[model samples]
Target: MPAQNPTGLPFDDIRHLVATMPAADQAAGDMARARQGDLLKPPGALGRLEEIAIHLATWQGKGMPSADRPMVAVFAATHGIADRGVSPYPGAVTKQMVGAFTDGKAAVNQICSAFDAGLRVFDLALDLPTPDITQDAALDERACAATIAFGMQAIAGGADVLALGEMGIGNTTIAAALCHALYGGEAEDWVGAGTGSTGEVLDRKIAAVKEAIAFHGAALSDPLEALRRVGGREVAAIAGAILAARHERVPVILDGYVVTAAAAVLHAMDASALDHCLAGHVSAEKAHGRLLEKLKLKPVLDLGMRLGEGSGAAVALGVVKAAVACHRGMGTFSEAGVSDKA
Candidate 1:
């Protein structure tokens, strides 16, 4: 994983790449809605499904589109802040749970299996052995390079869309801190109970996030520096994936608060980075709402979920697929000779 943007494409190029794809998906959705109108339904009888069709049309770059091959890329890394007790669980759980995900013993695995999605697990920090199950594994000399490169490779590996999830107990602290610095919020405001901590431990968690935010404020002036400051290997990796997804022209599905934090950093670095994103779901964490508002994103679901295992995004995959189907399949007004509101 050499550090090479050999083309030296400006961030503008990346921004353009990321920014322009939604139009295609949008056109697709519009076409779908037009067709649905022809299907003998009232102009807006299908309700939200019409919007879904339009969204699908846009996402697929066609008038009719389907989310046939959605993909999930979950990155796992250890964090230094876990040493400060920011999380109720130990940092060891990051590697162990990632191992479990790779071993197909986690919720993400079952969800992906159920959805028939292509799943990727990356050891961006090389903290654990590459289990037999990871579809793609990269361990290189430079963690940052490898992590970013892994993102490129994931897109090249035929992921229609990308979902970013992370494992690391204290990661919420780092992510919250990054969110504060990137989005100009207080760390206490963004920090939440990761892994379901309560009482005194939660208080400590909030304090730890505030501390990290204060310490990292200077470095956070630059997006990459902010990523380096409080970001775990997995988060940094997701940042790369976000940029790469933009470059590769794919829709990115974001999970909970932390992933939104990564998207926030990416957005601050390049505002157009958000153009390709479809927010998966709202998290129970309060920080998520603020971050989502900052990003101006509306989540597709609200399952009262606090889990950060990409499960929410996985569920959104189904919705996206259904949207695609509606766009591609439903009939239009003219075809059915239904209405005259043109």
Candidate 2:
């Protein structure tokens, strides 16, 4: 493939970027592991917290990981499939919710405040929705690649960790369609009644995903093509953000089905592409757990959270904080004058 897409965005650049991403620091992870055993606690006493600290240390390339500058980035876009009534909320709600995030009125806002994480909400051409997937590709190759480039800038301001969340009404349908195309199952396997769609609306949602797969055909075999066809702008942006995070050695916390769809595209290309990401939660939205299985990622929480907007990711940030505090703040058995088993 050429290094550039039709719009002059470098598709080859994306491919090379994912392929050449930095590997985790094995030395740092080993050091962190040694410290975990030295901490004044019984073996495995801290469970996932111990593991979480090692994951951060490995990716951050430090013996002690820092959750001090955790940041939550929310990408908001409008999906053309939303016009099909796949979600109960109107398409305009995508923009409205972005406003709510900036105004500190959204559920994620309270969670971010609680966690003391910086919050940044990005609006990706909400006024110009992507083409409806059932009838046409969601975006042209150039537009898709450009949106991805824009997403790569998400972490430019820098944070030690990145938690991704998205808001795009009817995006659950887009997410389902992307999954069906990428993973190949019954459309119903990936479909979910997002925002309370059920009965007739749910049927329409499934049907739309089926139509999109049929329409895209062989093109879906290529992850980038699948992304440009059925995926939304936020999906493209999220993929870019994930790549950017990997290149910069920032661990990612992914929220909900839509955000995972973005990661799926990268994972399809390189299985290790999402190695830095942690599934923040198993969403109440159906098929989410199934998708996580496909990614081989164990989520950090399972609170039945179906609300999008980085809410789940924000909640998991608190867990990450606990892990960091335990890993870095505690004294080793020797330093604390505690005895270790011989």
lDDT of 1 at 172: 75
Please, what are the lDDT tens digits per residue for candidate 2 over residues 39-152?
999989999999999999999999999998999999999988888888778999988889999899999999999989999999898899988998899888878888888998
Least accurate 10 contiguous residues by lDDT in model 2: 1-10
**Per-residue alpha-carbon lDDT of model 1 for 1-342, expressed as tens digits?**
223444554333333434443334555556665676666566677676666556545654666655677888887776656666656787778778878987899999998888888888876554642211111211222554455555566576666677777666777776777787677756577777767767887787777666666554575687656665566667756777877776555778899988888778778865666777888999898789888988999888999888888888998888877766665666656666666665
Off by over 4 Å in 1: 1-30, 126-146, 336-342
Off by over 4 Å in 2: 1-9
- Backbone-clash count (model 2): 0
> What's the number of clashes in each of the models?
14, 0
- Report how far residue 192 has shifted in candidate 2, in Å: 0.8
Angstrom error of the Cα, residue 301, model 2: value is: 0.6
lDDT of each: 0.69, 0.91
